[model samples]
Target: MKIKVNSEACIGCGACEQIAKDLFEIGDEGVSKAKVSEVPEDKKAMAQEAIDGCPTGAIQGEE
Candidate 1:
């Protein structure tokens, strides 16, 4: 599985980073983006949590 962050949609809220620091971070003018393209097996659940927790629905997941 993989994760993608919509730069336009992100508001730099940092929720993803807070929820899954290993998988996400604030970057590119302070937008929250995925730290890795492919989600690690152990981090997958937290990645989904970050996606679901994002207020703007900016994080997208790909299998």
Candidate 2:
């Protein structure tokens, strides 16, 4: 799976980072960014939760 954060749409609320720190982080510009391009199977569930938790729908995953 691939994980991506839409920097233009992200509000940087930190939900993604908080829910899945292994996959995301808040940048110096205050937007959420994907720490990695691909999501490991072991981390997909947590990544989904992070995607769901994002208020702005900035986090996305593709399988």
Candidate 3:
């Protein structure tokens, strides 16, 4: 699966990064960004957590 962050919806709250640092990061633009092109098998759960934890629902998972 792949993760995406909606720049327009993100608030730079850092919840996603805090929940899954390996999957997300606060980019130079001040919004959260996906760190990898795809989510690793072991990181899927964490990625989902980050998505769920996002205050603005900015994170999305794609097949």
Candidate 4:
């Protein structure tokens, strides 16, 4: 599974980070962005939660 972030849709909220800090992070500009971390298949559920929990709907899955 690959995580994709729509930077344009992100509103700098830390919701995703709160849900999955290992998979996401606040960028230098303070926007919520995908962290350069590996996500195991078992963590897909948590990742999905983070994606769905994003208030700005900025996160998605590639497959």
Give the clashing pairs for model 2: none
lDDT of 2 by residue, 1-63 (tens): 899999989998998999999999999999988999989899999999999999988887999
Worst 10 residues of 3 by lDDT: 48-57
- Reference-based lDDT, residue 34, model 4: 76
Best candidate, lDDT-wise? 1
At residue 43, candidate 2 shows an lDDT of 98
Worst 10 residues of 4 by lDDT: 30-39
Q: Tens digit of lDDT per residue, candidate 4, span 7-37?
A: 8899987988888888898989878777744
lDDT of each: 0.93, 0.92, 0.92, 0.83
Q: Which regions of candidate 4 deviate over 4 angstroms? A: none
Q: What lDDT is obtained when candidate 1 is compared to the true structure? A: 0.93
Q: How close is candidate 2 to the true structure, as a TM-score?
A: 0.95
lDDT for residue 18 in candidate 2, whole number 0-100: 91
| Residues 1-63 of candidate 3: C-alpha lDDT, one tens digit per residue | 998999999999999898899999999999999999799999999998998899899998987
Q: Better model by TM-score, 3 or 4? A: 3
- Can you write out model 1's per-residue Cα lDDT over 1-63, one digit (the tens) per residue? 899999999999899999999999998699987889999899989998999999999999988
Q: Rank the candidates by TM-score, best first.
A: 2, 1, 3, 4
